[model samples]
Target chain A: MSRIEVGQRILQEDLEWAKANSLLFHKHRVGCVNMISSPGAGKTTILTETINALSHDMRIGVIEGDVETDLDASRIRRTGVPAVQINTKGGCHLSAAQVNGALGQLPLERLDLIFIENVGNLVCPSIFDLGEHAKAVVLSTPEGDDKSAKYPAIFARSAAMLINKADLLACGALDFDVEKAIGQARRLNANLEVFVISAKTGQGLDQWCQWLRRLVSQVKILGQA
Target chain B: MHEAAIAEALLKTILDVAGGQRGRPLAARISCGQFAAVNPEALCFAFDALAKGTRCEGMRLQVEIRPVEARCSACGRIWTIDDGYSRCPNCSSQQFSLLPEPPLLLESVDFEDKTDE
Candidate 1:
């Protein structure tokens, strides 16, 4: 009745660390978003766009994770927001403990939204919860429509899907069908909200921004009540 | 790639749970839920490498695989699935609350203390 275990104890320990970080996030009233996707999927671009759009209206902070560079965090800081970069050295994903350490350097009390840009790997980040309210998977148009079926684990655990680089869809280089891709994603997470946005062209980003606004407002209302 | 980090995390948890036992531990048993996409071979390799020169060295690592299962909260239907299927089978409802099928649990540990007996 028992099967061979694969990373059970390790994952459990990570889960405990994740829970501890979650408690800190809740206490600070920070709505954390763990942004995950394949490398070159424009995770940082989306983050920059998000920060630019909301920085005027709300206080925002970012935790940029990468294998060995402060490049992403440096870019985020250019947007005039407090951003911290976590160099995993060789880690494929960002754990809650790492986030916990980086959080100490940032002003969590001043931020309404905290975006944790996970190391660019769909497979690894999905396994470790970074104490986020929800995790988002960003797939560029060129990644193809089949991503949902191919990497269901990330798609399944994602609370929402951001179809980036919509402008590239016209070039026929990307076999992406926004509607069908959304349909398949819904099969895994029925409540998943799909957004087609071009962080470069500024297309379909308003909807995403609006959704974020709603989430922030809801958090505010809940806190007040 | 993160398997090494995971292994390190596991060792810390084991030591904490063991409560500073007076002797070396023999082995540890763990259960991984089906939803957790962990390659057993990679994990074993990582664990072996991480355990080197540590107190947990030469200990047998046992991993148990737990398949993903879902029971609908509204319809009360239970179904076992491969990987990404999260909906209910009978009522086709998405309202089911997930049971913690994936244990990711450190079930038990074996410690050796020839001197303490």
Candidate 2:
């Protein structure tokens, strides 16, 4: 009997494919962001708002991921941007392979930004790299402030955290401590950028839209560089 | 939940590496970081379920969960943190980065040659 030593990463193959996918985006000068959150974190709302807000200046495309329905994709399409729906049919998160397939369907040359709205899952989605240039997590105020502490993995990996449902702060229904949430998230990831916004009331949408525009421009510059 | 995906990847890697080998894989040793948030038992169970009727059937999964190591940016003190806390235990500073890099990795694979026996 002989023992063979195979020291390698298990997901190296998937990661390589993801890297290739990223290269494809870079070639097209497309800035992609993977947005992840829990089921009711208002990802669709924020994404639709961002698309509407940036539609005039930037061409946007979306790959909506969900377990069963294409409703989110429909919502995105209503905003006059190209939208593709990926129904996992029970899978928890969207894989890079799936996104690679979706990339073929998108009008890559026409899009300045592509937002791959990951399946509404904080844990599994964070684990899978979808070849996005940036990873963002949306946390609704109703979901409570302790989520960053409980789900540190996603918070740590995310480049940006969008605190949605900020208008609900006046309702007094939730004891959402914004400071604690940002503190815990910063502890896990010191470089994490936090944005407090409400998708429903559009309270802080302008800042979020401006940040996204800057990211798109930066990506374009980097591609040229 | 995501353990299923992780297990499938693990088995696929073992099979690909053990290509042309005349025996089923006996075991695989994987290294996971505390920051990875992988449940060892769930991963094993998923592996067992997915390995059924495959070449990797009955393979033992040896998961080595690596504790998160944090380095204090202020004092330069390094310590292993198993609790997923980012703060340095020595200086109580929140500014630190996890050490021993690569969050999750498959360190090695162990297989027995049944044809020789």
Candidate 3:
């Protein structure tokens, strides 16, 4: 009996597919951002607001992933940007293979930016790289500031974080400590950029859209990378 | 669960390695991060069931879950952490780099070699 040490990545195929997606994005000069959050964290609302704020100014595409419903994708389509709906059936996270298929369905060359709204999940989605240039996580104030401490994996990997639903805190309906959430997330990733936003009140949407434009320009207009 | 999906990938990897060999696979060793949230039981169950009609039927599995380790970027002290707590024990600094950890890795495989070596 011989013991062969075959050190391999168990999800090599999925990761390879993700890599291919990056190449596709690079060739098309598309700025793909993967958005992650828990359920009811205002991902769809923020997307609609952001798209409404920037669709006329920049070319954007959307890929919505959910366990069962296409409602989010439908909502994104109302913003007049092309959005694809991927129903995972029961999968907790969107896989690289699934994203690859979605990428094929989009108008890659015609768009300068793409947003993938991942299934509302904190854990599984953070682990999978969908070949996006950046990962943006949405954390609503009602979810509590300690969420970053609990789901550090996601916080650590995210490039930018949106503290959504800040209007709740303004009205004294919730007591989410924005500084505490930012501190916890920054502990994991020192360079994390944060935005306190409220999709309902139109607070902080300008800065969020501004960041999105800068990222889009970095990849499309300048980097071509 | 993604366990079934991950199991299929693991089985495919082991089979690819065992391909064209004179003997069948006997055991495999893998490692996962402590915070990867993968349930070993579900993975093993899926692997065993998928291996039922193959040469890898009843294969033994050795799974090692490694804790999260980090290095203080300031004081150059390395420490192991249980989870998301990233503060360095020595320097009490949050400015540190986490050790690179792949979520899942198949380290080694054991197989019977029927052919003359």
Best by TM-score: 2
Task: Kindly report which residue pairs in candidate 3 clash with one another.
Answer: none
Q: Each candidate's chain A: what TM-score? A: 0.92, 0.98, 0.96
- DockQ pick, better of 1 and 2: 2
Q: Model 1: per-residue lDDT, tens digit, A7-53?
A: 33556556777898777777777777889999999999998998888
Q: Score the docking of each candidate (DockQ).
A: 0.31, 0.60, 0.63
lDDT of 3 by residue, B34-101 (tens): 65667789888989999999878999988888887878889999888765766788979888766776
For candidate 1, the docking band is acceptable
TM-score of chain B of 1: 0.75
True contacts kept of each: 0.33, 0.55, 0.71
Clashing pairs in 2: none
Rank the candidate models, highest TM-score first: 2, 3, 1
lDDT of 3 at A95: 92
Model 3's DockQ score: 0.63
How well is each residue in A100-203 modelled by candidate 3, as lDDT tens digits?
99988999989989999999999889878899999999999989999977887788788999999898886887768888888888877778999999998899
Task: Estimate the TM-score of every prediction.
Answer: 0.87, 0.94, 0.92
Q: Is candidate 1 or 3 superior in DockQ?
A: 3
For model 2, the stretches where C-alpha displacement exceeds 4 angstroms are B99-103, B113-117
Scoring the B chain of model 2 against the true B chain gives a TM-score of 0.83
Give the range where candidate 1 chain A is weakest over 10 consecutive residues by summed lDDT.
A1-10
